[model samples]
Target: MLLKIDVASTVPLYQQIHDQIILGLASGQLQPDEALPAVRQLADELAVNMLTVAKGYNLLKAEGYLISDRRQGTRVAANFQADAVFMQALQEQLHQLTAAAKIRGLDVKDVQELVAAQYQSFEGE
Candidate 1:
């Protein structure tokens, strides 16, 4: 997986890594059960601290998006399901985004179209 980190962005490095991995999974660029680089290896490649990469990996593991074993290393979780906690979080995020769009005077149809485009991009992946 190629993860692009915007060092100049206000977003935290770990969060960027976490989000990119999620996008990769959604776009099917990263496949189920695919082994990810070791934390240290990824850190070195991304020129970030190992702890940052580890933190991202740990968060994904806790969210059931990844699994790690001493013998097998870390791999994308296969047959992952969106549990209730994840669904609630997703709804909250959508709520915030919708509010932001409204505040910016974006029409509902515009927002819906943007959403549809993104949703369709993930299709047949």
Candidate 2:
């Protein structure tokens, strides 16, 4: 897992970590039984404090996306799927994208065309 941290971004460091893990989960990059890097190790890799990684892990744990066991270490939660809240969050992000695109002068038709092209390109791969 390669994690690139942008310390200057407005997004909180913990959220960057959280979102990356969520993407990893969705893309099947992280397996259910896989042990995550120790929080300290992840901090070292990202050159951030252990607390940042721990905070992200805690959030994921609370959301039932991962589980932390002292003996077995931290692993993804088996059979986990996005809940209603997660889906709503995703929808909100999509809305933000559309709003931003419109603000940048992308008309509705242009936006739809762009999305269609991108969707087709994605499926082609």
Candidate 3:
């Protein structure tokens, strides 16, 4: 899994890590039961603190997106699926993005086309 971090972005480091992992999982770049790097290793790779990476891992574990064990290490949940809350969050984000686009003078058809394009771009990945 490749993760890109933008230190200058307003988004917090931990959230950035968490979001990228989620996107990886959604896009099938990550597999179920695939082990992620140890917290210290990931922290080193990202030039961040261990606790920062651990915080993101903990959040994912709490949401059932990951499983962590001292012996086996951290892995994607074997049966991970977006729950209702996850779906709702996605819908909320879409709503916000479409609203912003509308405010920027994009019509409904334009927004729909953009969404369709994005969805299609993810196909057969």
Q: Pick the candidate with the highest TM-score.
A: 1
Taking the tens digit of each residue's C-alpha lDDT, what string does model 1 give over 8-95?
9999999999999999999999999999999999999999999999999999999999999999999999978878999999999999
Off by over 4 Å in 3: none
Error of 3 at 51 (Å): 1.5
Candidate 2 stretches with Cα past 4 Å from truth are 108-125
Ordered from best to worst lDDT, the candidate numbers read 1, 3, 2
TM-scores for every predicted model: 0.94, 0.73, 0.85
Top candidate, metric lDDT: 1
Candidate 2 lDDT, 1-125, residue by residue in tens = 68777999999999999989877776667778778888988999999999999999999998888898889888888877668988887799889999999899989999899879866663443
Q: Which runs of model 1 end up more than 4 angstroms from their true locations?
A: none
What is model 3's C-alpha RMSD? 1.8
lDDT (CA) per prediction: 0.96, 0.86, 0.91
